[model samples]
Target: MGKSRHEKRAAIREHKEARRDRCESDAYLDANSRVIKAERNIPWWRR
Candidate 1:
């Protein structure tokens, strides 16, 4: 009924990879992204 050792290690690796992706996504959408989107709305003449 128990998982084998390889299955346990694979599960741990998947968990760590998911956690890393979450952290990266949070960092990716900070003030920089906000500024970029805001900039798109302005005409070239305005800037």
Candidate 2:
């Protein structure tokens, strides 16, 4: 069966929260600013 609209939105919200937490925890600790900036410059579609 297909999920209801509310369920879909809740799943998306949960995923976003998890991603935000992960990004916050990393916070440039794993890589330097130059590498991160280069990554950011790339188009999302290419990535």
Scored against the true structure, residue 39 in model 1 reaches a CA lDDT of: 97
Q: State TM-scores per candidate.
A: 0.52, 0.52
> In terms of TM-score, which candidate is strongest?
1
1-47: candidate 2 lDDT, tens digit per residue: 99999999999999999988887666555566768788899999988
Name the lDDT of candidate 1: 0.89
Q: How would you encode candidate 1's per-residue C-alpha lDDT over 1-47 as one tens digit per residue?
A: 89999999999999999988887686676866898999999999997
Candidate 1 minimal-lDDT segment of 10 residues: 23-32
lDDT (C-alpha) at residue 13 in model 2:
100
With a 3 Å backbone cut-off (N, CA, C), the pairs that clash in candidate 2 are: none
Instruction: Report how far off residue 4 is in candidate 2 (Å).
Output: 0.4
